[model samples]
Target: MVEFAMLVIVGGALVAMVMIYLRGRSGFRVANPESGTLYVTGVSPRPDATGAQYVTITGNLTGPSVPGTVVYGRMAWDVNDWPAIGDLIPVVYPSGKPERWQLSRPGARPGLGS
Candidate 1:
């Protein structure tokens, strides 16, 4: 009985792990990264579930699409790393899909007053 119980517990754990992995992968499925512009809109006053801040951005994407298609996106950042309002930041997103984007320069911080 004890062995059977342990086996069931292990199997349940494995199934849970697989489900979590699949969900994460599908939730963040972006591809064909291309350069786009980010117009800082505002920063959230409260932190997210992970205790990270979120910056809101809205702008027209420069990818292959019907021009003038604006995208509104929010990116998580450290509390002290939020961008200033009206700032223009270069970002990369999947071609024709600027909603899912990230900073073009790896590890680059925004709004340094430069």
Candidate 2:
């Protein structure tokens, strides 16, 4: 019984550690943000239940270190304002990490440059 108890405790600890690591990795974002341009590549054929469509966007990194590094992400866009192919949109991403980015909102402070 004691050995079984110990095994359970160890297993629980391992699960907790894995959860923490996974959460941090997905939630990680850099503090110093930089402005980048994202060109619309494609949009989902159907909208979700929320009436939002998944959009595929790709863009080249705009930093000296990762110049020309292309990054891609999928964003949920409103049905009314779906992006068209070849549309350019402003975006902000963490310095050195272009994979994590989001669309830039007007009047909101953008990273690095104003």
Candidate 3:
């Protein structure tokens, strides 16, 4: 009986976590996402005092709407999957906010700088 109750509690927690993740994903779709060439000009030194590594990928947009706008975003520790300098990637943003561009892998991209 106790095992069943514990399973229910764990299941509920997992479900809640999925819901929260989905909710945040909804924001990524709140506005139309634009694609652009990611120009990685720099990357900051990682593993700060908190021992947390962060990668700041910088680039710009070239679509009709946020054309050539300087944009940047950060991601968690040692993302070996991140693109190289002068690589084309997808850039997304909230509605009417070009400066809030985010770098994301479109569909099922596997190769770096592909």
Report, for all candidates in order, the number of backbone clashes: 0, 0, 0
- TM-score for model 1? 0.54
- lDDT, candidates in the order shown: 0.65, 0.64, 0.60
Runs off by more than 4 Å, candidate 1: 1-29, 45-51, 64-66, 105-107, 111-114
lDDT of 2 by residue, 11-63 (tens): 99999999999987665544788877765555455454555667565555454
True-structure lDDT of candidate 2: 0.64
Collision count of model 3 = 0
Q: Is candidate 1 or candidate 3 better by TM-score?
A: 1
**Residue runs of model 2 more than 4 Å from their true location after superposition:** 1-30, 46-50, 61-66, 106-114
Q: Could you tell me which 10 consecutive residues in candidate 1 have the lowest summed lDDT? A: 105-114
Q: Say which candidate scores most in TM-score.
A: 1
Poorest stretch of ten by lDDT in candidate 2 = 105-114
